[model samples]
Each structure stands twice: as structure tokens, then as C-alpha cells.
Target: MRAVVIEQPGTVSVQDVPDPIPGPGDLVVAVRGAGICGTDIHLLDGELPYDRYPIVPGHEFYGEVVDVAGDIDRARIGRLVTVDPNMPCGACAECRRGRANLCERYEALGVTTDGAAAELVRVPAGLAYDLPADVSDVGAVLTEPLACAIHGFDGLPRRPQDRYLVYGAGTMGLMMGLLAADMTSEPVTVIEPNPSRRALAESFGMRAVSSPEEVDPDERWESVIDCTGVVEAIEDGLGRVRRGGVFQCFGVTETDAMVKLRPFDIYRNEITVIGSMAVHNSFDRAHRLAQVWGDEKLAPLVTHGYALDDYAEAIRTFRDGAGLKIAIRPGGLA
Candidate 1:
């Protein structure tokens, strides 16, 4: 099997590797579509503390089951599925409290082990969800990220009729905005520095602007979400939350990053600030949502596709912000 291997930080190459063999209770999938994520870039740059070098780096993916082992049902072979890459230690204190995303011993497929940026990858059968026949390849590929967005929403107050202000118009930002629009009657406003991204957001019926200044100065949102993972954006978003409103930190900022916020204001205004991590029990729900919106809303978010051999180009395109969602087709397009 050929895969994109990160030999170490700042070093990556496509090379032939031995095919993955499923262990007990696992299945081997023939990779169909794998989406490149910011985490992949972080892994390449040694930005993430959990990432392992000499590892394959794709987690947002869907594929066909080619083989199964142990107690897995043989009928699963040939079924198209999307996998939840996070495998928490069920006995951890956080997992016992139903917050598996914060499990003390976290093991994500792409980050901790070899992943789907190859012709074949092995995954635990329990983590795989079968996709409906009508679900498009693009929709299947987006399940993971959509699940993360859903988890992010789970952390919000979710007050009915609450206005939403989101920062950034990238893939995650756009998804967050779309979900916010569905949750409220009021238009969702997005702040994106890139004109092209702002245009894309407007095309989806959201109010898009290059900066917060473009919005009414007195405007405040009941729910403010920062998806840019940028310090400046986070600070600006905090200031735009309405008194007694909630602010969600949905972006992945630096571990040591710090921002200025008056502790007194949080208490005086009764503001709620929360953070959302990776996928929880939202993977199956995300797949169902994709099935509902795939053709109309979700699928359109995918703007580019490259062959597995073109992983380098895919990374370049992603870094350049050339498209909304970029997919790597390991088995080529079906």
C-alpha cells in the first residue's frame, strides 16, 4: 500500500508500506475518500502533542469494508462506512462521567496510530457507521468534522431565537455558521478576512463581512463561536457576546495561548464561556444529518479532490486556502 508518511516533523513523503491487517474486532477498509484537516498540518509541523511521527495522517474519511476479523460480522465486507477515529479508554474517569471526549487516555486513529491516508487502513468495527446508499462520497467524507461541529453545539446554551456570530469562514467555520442558521431565525453573521471566503459565506445566505467593524458596533450575539483558532479573533468574539449570553471556543488554539478578558465582566455580565473538544457520541447523528443535507448543503462544501499520490498538492492547496474541503481519493473516484 502507498501512503503519505510523516517521517518526522517537517518531513513527509509518499512511499509504499505494508498493508494493514485487522486485529480482533477490527476491519480493514479500502480507503475511498479522505479529507485533509488542520490537524494533519499540525502533525506535519509537530504542533500537536499527541501526534506520532512516521504515521499516516488522515482521519476524516469513509471507505468500503474489505475484510473483517474476530467477532466482526462477515456481512460487513463491502459496506460503505465512515469511522469515528476517537477511541477513548472506557474506564477513564471522564469516560465514566459520559464525557468520553476528555478521556484521560486518548487514542485517536490518525494522531496515535496509522490512519487512512493510504490504500488500506484498519479500524475498530464498533467505531464504523454504515452509510445510506443515497449518501454521496463527499457527504461520507464530511461526517467526522460534522460530528465535531455537533459536539461543539452540544456545549452551547442553544437558546431558541439566539443570534449567532461566528469568526472565520473556513470549512469548520462555514459548517458552524450553517448549523447556527438552522438553530435560529435571525441571520448568522460571519467574520472572515478573506474576501473569497466571505463571498462563499454570503452565497450560503449568511451575512458575511471582512471584519467585526462591518457589523453594527452595538450589535451583540446571544451565542458567539470562534472557529478561527486565532487569538485576536477569540478576543474580539468575547467582546461581542451579549450580557448573559454564551461564548463557545470551538477552534483549536495553541496550548499555551493566552487572551485578555476581564474576570469581573464575566461575573457581572453573567457570561458563559465553554470549550468543545473532539467528537463525542455525535458520529452517528452527524451521518444522519449528512444524509439529510448531503445533496443540498453538505456536498457542495467539497470543492477539490486529489488522488492519493497527490497528497503533497492537497496539503499545498489546503494551506493556500484554495478551496472549502479538499479530499484525497486513495482508491480513486468510484
Candidate 2:
């Protein structure tokens, strides 16, 4: 099996590796489509808090089940499925409290373990969800990221008719805008500096602007989301929240990064600030949504695709912000 191996931070290679053998209660999947995420870049640059080198780096993926462990149902073989990569320690207090996404002992595919940037990968059967036949390959691959966006919505005070203001028009921000559009009758507004991204957001029917200044200075949103993971965006978004509104930090940022906030303003305005981590019992719902929106909406988000051997090019394309969602097809592009 050929896999993308990150020998260490700043080092990557495509090399032959042993085919994955499923452990008990696990299944081996022949990789089909895998989406490259910003976290992958972080892993490559050693920006993450922990180090898991010599590891394959892909988690947003789906594929056909090629084999199953002895304990798993044999009928699962050949089924197309999407996996939830976050593996939380079931015994953790957070898990007990139904907040497993914040598990103290966190391990996830592509982060702490070898993942789907390969011809074959092993995943726990419990984490795998059978993707509906109606879901396109692009939709199936997006289940993980959509699940994270769903979790982000779960953290919001989702009142009916609440307006949404989102920072960044990148993949995650666009998804957030899509979800926000569905949640309320109000138009969703997205702030994106890139002209192309802003145009893409407008094509999706969202109000897109180059900066907050472009929007009415007095305008405020009931739900403000910062998806850029940028300090400037986060700071700007905080000030745009309406009185008693909720602000969610949906993007990943440096662990030590700090943003200036007016504590007094927040206290007086009764604003709530929250952070959404990863998937939390949302994969199945995201998969269902993908089935509903696959060809019509979700699939269009995948603007680029690459063969497994072209992982380097995929990374470059992603870093250059050349497309919306870039997929790596380990089994070759369809």
C-alpha cells in the first residue's frame, strides 16, 4: 500500500507501507476520497500541541470496506462508508458528561495515528457510518468537516430569525453560511478578503464582503462566527455581536494565541462567547445531510481533486487557497 507519510515536521514522502490489518471490531477500507484540511497543514508545520510523526495525515475521508475484523459483520465488506476520526477515551470524564469532543485523552485518525492518506486504512467499526448511495464521492468525503460545522451550530444560541455574520469565506466559513441560511430566513453575511472567495460566497446566495467596513457600521448579528482562525477576524467579529448574541470561535488557532476583547462591553451587552472543537455525535446527522444535499449543494464545494501521489501538489494548492475543497483520491480520481 502506498501512503503519504510525514516523516517529521516539515518532511513528507509518498512511500510503500504495509497494508493495514483491522484489529478486533475494526474494518479496513480502501481509500477513495480524502479531503485536505487546515489541520493537515498544522501537522506538517509542527504547529499542533502534540507531535505524532511518521504518520499518515488524512482524516476527512470515505471509502469502500475491503475487509473486516473477525468480530465485525462480514456483510460490511464492499459497503461505502465515511468515518468519524475523533477517538475519545470512553472512560474520560468528558465522555461521561456527553462532551467527548473534549476528551482528555484524545486520539484521532491522521493526528495521533496512521490515517486514510493511503491505499488502505483501518478504522474502528463503531466510528464508521454507511454513506447513503445517493451521496456523491465528494459528499461522502466531506462528512467529517460537515460534522464539525454541525457541532459548531450546536454551540450557538440558535433562535429563529437570528441573523448570522461569519468571518472568512473559506470552506468551513462557506459551510457555516450554508447552515446558517438553512437555520434562519435572514440572509447570511460572510466577510472574506479574497475576491474569488467572496464571489464564491455570493454564488451560494450569501452576502459577501471584503471587510466588516463594507457592512453597515451599525449592523450587528445575533450569531457571529469567526471561521478564519485569525486574530484580527476574531477581534472584529466579537464587536459585531448583537446585544445578548452568541459568538462562536469555529476555527483552529495557535494554542497560545490571544485576542483583545472588551470585557466590559461583553458584560454590559450580555454577549456569550464559545468555542466549538470537533465532531460530537454529529457524524450520522452530517452524513444524512450530505445525502440530502450531495449533488445539489455539497458536491459543488469540492473544487479540486488529486491523485494520492500528488499529495504535495494538493498541499500547495490548499496553501495557495486555490480552491474551495481539495480532495486526494488515493484510489485515483473518478
Candidate 3:
């Protein structure tokens, strides 16, 4: 099997590796498509902590069941499936409370264990889900990411006429804007410094602003979402949200990063400051939207796709341009 392994922090290589075989309760999935995530970038940058080196680095992925055992449905073979990525200990306090995303003993597939960046991967059968018939393999791979955005919005009670602003124009930011648009008559405003991403947002009928500093003070927003996870961006967004409105921090910043907030502002305005960590009961929501809308709504976001051998070029494409989503068809579907 061929795989891209993270030999160490800030290093990676595509090489031949042993094929994964299913364990008692595991199933082998033939890799099909994998979506690169911001977490991957964080892993490459030595930002996010993870297990020791020589591990396959991937999690947002889709594939077909190649082998299964142990009371599992044999019919899953050859069916396209997307991974849940996060495996929680069901007995944990968080899991018992139905908040598996925040499970105390959480293990992430690509970070804590070897992931689906190769020709095949073996995972616990319970975490695999069949891709809806109407969804493309590429689109199905985006479920994890969309689920994160869904969880971010879930923190607040949304209203049909609530004016919202999404700060950032990356894949997560744009997805937030699009999803908010679907729920409200109030326009969704996107704040992105990148001209290309701003232009891309414009094509989708959303308002785009280059910076929060440029937004008129008179402009009021009921909800503001900070998707960049950058400290500066999060701080700037706070000042724009209306009194009694909600402000969501959707991204995690560096450990050392700090944002100075005025407690008086929150006290006087009755503002709600919330943080969304990860997907919780959002896979089904994203899957339903993917099934109903198909690829058209998200096609604009997938700016480039590459083959397994072109992983370097794929990273360059994402780093150098304002492309929303860069994908890899590990099995040549791209």
C-alpha cells in the first residue's frame, strides 16, 4: 500500500507501507478521497499535539468497505463510507451525557492513530457511515468539516431575521456564511482579507468585507462568528456584534495567543460569548444537507484536486492561493 506518513513534526513523505488488516471489530476501507483540513496544517506546523511520528496523516476521508468481520453487515462491502474520525470511550462522563465530541478520553483517528491516507485503513465498524447515494465521494469527505460548522452554529439559537457576520473566508468561514444564509432572511456578511476569497463569496450572493476595521460603526449584526481562530480576528469581531447578540469563536488559536476583552462591554451589552469545539450530532445534519443539495452548492469551494502522487502540489495550491477546499483522490477518482 502507498501512504503519506508524517515522519516527524514539520515533515511528511509519500511511501509504500503495509496494508491494514481488520481486527475483530474493525473493517478495512479502501481509500477513495480525502479532504485536507486546517488541523492537518496545524499538525504540519507542529502546533497541535498528537501521537508519536511515522503515522499516516489524514481523517477527513471517504472510501469503500473492502473487508469486514464480527457480526458486522457483510453488505457494507463496496459501499462508500465516510469516517467519524473521533472515537470516544462510551463510558466517559461526556459520552454518557451525549457529548461525545468532548469526550474525556477522546481519540482522533488521524492524530491519535493512523488515518486513511493510504490505499487502505482499518477502523472500528461503529464509526463508519455509508455515503448517501446522491452525494459524490468528494462531497461526502466534506461531512466532517461541515459538521464542525454546524456545531459552531448550534451554540446559539438562530432566528430567521437575525443579521449575521462570518469573519474569515476560508472553507470553514465560507461554509458558515452559506449555512447562515440558508437559515435567515438577514444577509450574511463575510470578512476576509484575501481578495480572491472575498470575490468568491460575492459570487455566492453574500456580502464580503476585507476587514472589521473597515465595517461602518452603524452596521449592526445580531450574531458574529469568528472562524479564523486567530486571536486578532476574534478580538476584532467582538466589537461588531450588537448588544445582547451572540459571538461565536469557531476556531482554536495558539496556546500562547491572547485576546484582551473588556468585561465592562459584556456586562453593559449583555453579550453572549460562546466557543464551539467540534462536531456533535452534526454528521447527520451535514449528511442531510449534502444529500438534498448535492455538489453544486459546494463545487465552488473545491478549487483544486490531485492524485496521490501529487500531495506536495496539492499543499502548495492550498497555501499559495485562496482556494476554498483542496482535495486528493487517493484512488484516482480525482
Question: Which portions of model 3 miss their true places by more than 4 Å?
Answer: none
Against the reference, the lDDT scores of all candidates come to 0.90, 0.91, 0.82
lDDT string for model 1 (1-334, tens) is 9999999998988999998989999999998999999989999999887646789989999999999999899999999999999999999899999999999998888888999999999999999999876667777999999999999988887877999999999889999988888888888999998988888899889999998788888899999999988999999898889999999999988889999999998999999999999898899899888777876787668989999888899999999888789999988754
Could you tell which candidate, 1 or 3, scores higher by TM-score? 1
Q: lDDT of candidate 2 vs native?
A: 0.91
The local distance difference test score of model 3 is: 0.82
Backbone clashes in each candidate structure, one number apiece? 0, 0, 0
- Residue lDDT tens for model 3, 1-334: 8888888877887899988878788889988778887777777677776656777878888788999978888988988888888888889898999889888887887877888777788899988878865556546868788888888888876888899998888889888888898888766899899999999888878899898777897787889999888888888888888999999988778778889999999999999999898778887787667655557777777777788878877777777754778777778853
Backbone collision tally, model 1: 0
Predicted structure with the largest lDDT when compared to the true one: 2
Report the Cα RMSD per candidate.
Answer: 1.2, 1.0, 1.6
On a 0 to 1 TM-score scale, where does candidate 3 land against the true structure?
A: 0.95
